[model samples]
Target: MSTQHDAEIDALLGRYFDGLYHSDSSVLRTVFHTDLSYVNGTDGTYETMGLEDYMARIDARTPPASRNDPREEVVERIALKGDRIGIVEARMTMLGRNYQDLLTLINTDEGWRVLTKVFSFVERKD
Candidate 1:
């Protein structure tokens, strides 16, 4: 792949973080594949779903951006498995929750798309 691959991943991840913070389904749709699997295993809570349901959940929430929440997000690492597959480790905070996300992506004809997301989050009380 080209050296610009890293930049593409970074830009995609930026959109991911921005989408989550703002609860913008349209933005997120560009980040996640339609058949994407969503896994949440945090503090003994195990939940799994698909992109449509995930979007519904996002739509139901009061967006952090609306509350003037601070965004503390970072991409810890990204590893490419050949030319078509990639894995990313990321961290972020929203709605007083701290999250660690492992995202697996597939490079499609349309570009890189998040195919699966396994994440854990801790609720923060302050």
Candidate 2:
């Protein structure tokens, strides 16, 4: 892929972080596919989420940003596979917990959108 494509993916990731921090479903919808599958294993049991349900959960929450404790998310890696598929790993911290997310993205006609996510979290004792 060209540098331009890489830049676009980077920009999309930026929006992802923004959406996650603010829990803004609008911003999130821009980057997540309609058929998204989200998985969380923080509790030692897997919890799965679908796109619409996840959006609804976002809407019901009070954004951490509003509390001045917005989650901090960092993109650790982005690996593109050919022109259509990519993998992204990111870290986030909020409420004394650290989160690690591995996202699968596809470059669709609408642009690069996350198709699936697998995540885990650990609570900080200190």
Candidate 3:
């Protein structure tokens, strides 16, 4: 069904947002693949992180929720390539930035997992 991707992606995004809001790498580990790669190029520079470094950075950050920072996310689209490959487009705001994310997914034996995340961010208006 067309809505199925929406449901599954929504659930995944929920966890993603929670992990980010709390800066909880443990929570993120559940949803993100161990091989996940995060990329960002909004500043005209190629910035990227592998899961280990990403998790460590997450662990080191101040939890946005603790600072009462606003949490906002909208899943703009979700589509599947056959049944195994998928992609999700989303926008979110956190930690003084607004981000547009392209999340590549794969339906593993373990269910849908984020394989790679390419994102661009701009500083949020205060």
Candidate 4:
């Protein structure tokens, strides 16, 4: 990838990570496609959900009170096959647990938007 492409991917990574940490749903919406879907691993089960359902689930699980001090870390790897498509793998640590998310993004009329996401939890040893 050229330096400019790398920079764009870096910016996208930063926005997505910052949004998750701050629980900024508006930012999340911008990164994710309207029809985005994913399977979230929780308690040894993979629960599939769409964008709206996922947002509601996030709202339900993350209490407004607890978000006063939300913590997050994201390590991402991006691969660009061409100018309009890329894959992003993000390993995230949030609320003392680790999760892995693989996302496919496409440059659309509105800019880069997430096409699909596959995610799973990673058991942390402490």
Best by TM-score: 1
Candidate 1: which stretches are off by over 4 Å?
none
Better of 2 and 4 by lDDT: 2
Q: Which TM-score value belongs to model 2? A: 0.91
Q: Model 3 reaches what TM-score against the true structure?
A: 0.92
For each of the candidates, the C-alpha root-mean-square deviation to the true structure, in angstroms, is 1.5, 1.7, 1.5, 2.7
Q: How many clashes does each candidate structure show, in the order listed?
A: 0, 0, 0, 0
TM-score, model 1 to reference: 0.94
lDDT of 2 by residue, 1-126 (tens): 365578889889899888877889999999899999999877876899899999999899878788888467788988888889989999988756788999999999999999998999898676
lDDT scores of the candidates, listed in order = 0.91, 0.88, 0.88, 0.74
TM-score of each: 0.94, 0.91, 0.92, 0.80
Candidate 3 C-alpha lDDT tens digits along 15-93 = 9989999999998887798899899878776788999999999999999999999889888988889878889899999
Candidate 3's displacement at residue 106, Å, is: 0.5
Residue runs of model 4 more than 4 Å from their true location after superposition: 1-3, 41-43, 63-76
Better of 1 and 3 by TM-score: 1
Task: Give candidate 4's whole-model lDDT.
Answer: 0.74
